[model samples]
Target: MLIMATKLNKKLLKTLSAVLFSAVVFVGCNDFFGDKTDLSFIDLPEFTNRDIAYVPIQPAWDQFVYPTDICIGFDELLYVVDEATQQIIGLDESGREQGRFSVPGVTSVTQDRRFDLLACGTLDTVSASGDPITLACIYRIRLLNQNGQYGIRYARIVNKIIHPFYSRSNVNAQDLTVRFGKVAIMASDIPSQNNRYYVTRQGQGGSSILGPNDAVLIFSNTDQFETPISVSTSSGIFNNFFQKPSGIATYAVPPQIQASQERHFFYSSVDPANELKVQFIEYIETDFGAEFRPVIFPVGDTSRADGFLFEPNKFSKPSAIAVAGDNTRFLFVVDEEKDSLFQFTRDGFEGVLPPPATGRTKLEKASFGGTGNGLTQFNRPSGVGYYRRIVYVADSGNGRILRFRLTLDFN
Candidate 1:
């Protein structure tokens, strides 16, 4: 039983070394990300073995010049708004064009349960000198069925929603989201600074860039958008600084084993320093009104923070976050830069939840089929929303909306 004696044979020794090396490599290759991967040494599990799956959706219609935002109608039709074309295109589930509409001055679109849509844009007016600048405007689009297809017939100006003050109100609405009968609007001005009440206060020695920290305006219970309640994310916790809130969704499910309703709001903050941060603000009702406290989640590793970009870059900056219906623990984020999707479990956050298994982890975290060549496959993936078990992605860059089914059983 003297096994060491076998080392005397050169051929056997070489085979033994090869077997050991293969075992080591196999042990190191257990990854759970996606079709694309990033880390050099990290080899992902082959897609076939893993329970995860993806179906590429092709556009049924022509591509928009530069699609930016998207939303799904209650009827299950997908609507896309293109910034370059200044037009709204509709597509069926199969990716074919169902209908289309045009606007004079519109930039983005968001839809609600009422089958009403919110169109955001900057109203441009010429000065006496003939130079053009933008003023903020939001239009509520009412859709009607014309010959078995959806059509946009009437648009109304949503003046005076949540923020009632409106002194020199030049906030250009960027994103619109509606939940629990409340429509949320986000906007900023010239310096891209946000303030509670933006006031220049004539001759008070104001800074050229001074304004209320960025604002989140909430419009509630009115198709007219007349009665608005404004909520500000600025507080001492923000410590007299500024944070920009983008892509908001409301979480209003009943607290488990509790009597009261839980109203939680989730948003992405693209602060230059903390561009990878996602903030969760909870609203607890008090005698006066709603109270705001922000819980911040720093994305990726803080060590490589410099790579984080507020503006679109090669690596994705978490642009939008949405909660899947069945499990609040399942959260999805769309990276506008990489034009990909990332899924994280509740435990994935360093909070009360336990860490999710490798199978239930981040996807699209790296280069697939090698380097820059693979990105051309994606256009500009934007906003994500859900209806029942189905997930909808606004394939903005591709000029179509892709539908997918959410599943688990990662091998």
Candidate 2:
């Protein structure tokens, strides 16, 4: 009887040890490994659809074949870029056609700090020797009043060529943002081409050629191309690899931060898995010089890629992003594939981590315009812009611009 009891006691001890060991492993996995399988998608607040306010389809203006971008000028006018016509059409706050300007190969437009209109496009100009030179450049235009009529006059052109040896075809300026007299341009490389270009503060004349990657070229206050931030480097803040950068936006960091002098910019790219990825980059003034580096922001207890707040399946081919100027907390992302508009608060991702953390960076609101050519719907919406409390969407398929007023009830 004693021998049998001893064996039973030994077996009980072994079973308890095994259980304790399993518990330790489970705890370690939760604390250290961040067991993503246990995470669930965040339940976001429902978006209530209000009535669509205005749809600008002016018969006086040429039909928009493909409106790629839109921006609000200091004059409170909406500037729409028609890629098919290579022209910019201006409209008043009430959606009345104000005027239009011809800009050849114009892809994007923005207002500078000085209230001058800056446009990025491809230009063909003659050199001193009468040789025709086609270059991708930024044109500064001033809105002038001629006999009570508004007109656009060419201020100057910044020819973006780092070296003469490089073919002009290598430089393609897609999107740009101008702030504090500085312009950050997203210049995409030719598809399947490995050569890249970077701009220096020394002006377009001092631009440099990088090996190959999608890059953001920074133009200094003097209107010179100053630095190139690439996505291929492991050193900067963005350690992830991405290609095919599509859209860009710039926002100002508050003065209280340690790096207040720096400028914050966001660029979007398609990852290898075809996921739309957006990252936040900062132009830091270092001891060496002004450099563009990646930044990480707080997300819950852990941190994540600064501007990368979306999940892998969050967007299907996100084409454009726009941040609200009046309320910086609002961010709008347009998915061209699904014809969906996702709205998120900047603070929504505070405690969430990626990989099945569905609710982590909760989407504050979402609007789905089923694929159609209707007044309320969008067909292949390409770009979005927000100003005041109004949201402007480039309904490219419908050949018109749609404006909507957002009514959020966070309560």
Provide TM-scores for the models.
Answer: 0.57, 0.60
Q: Over the stretch 76-155, how does candidate 2's per-residue lDDT look in tens digits?
A: 67788887898877777676666678776776677644345666666576655666666555666667543544434323
The numbered model that scores best in TM-score is: 2
Runs in model 1 with CA error above 4 Å? 1-49, 57-62, 127-131, 145-150, 153-165, 169-213, 221-242, 252-262, 287-289, 296-316, 326-329, 346-379, 398-400, 407-411
Give the per-residue Cα lDDT of candidate 2 at 32.
79
Weakest 10 consecutive residues of candidate 2 by summed lDDT: 193-202
Where model 2 places Cα greater than 4 Å from the true spot, the runs are: 1-63, 125-135, 145-209, 230-242, 252-262, 271-276, 284-291, 296-308, 347-364, 409-411
The global C-alpha lDDT for each of the candidates, from Candidate 1 onward, is 0.45, 0.52
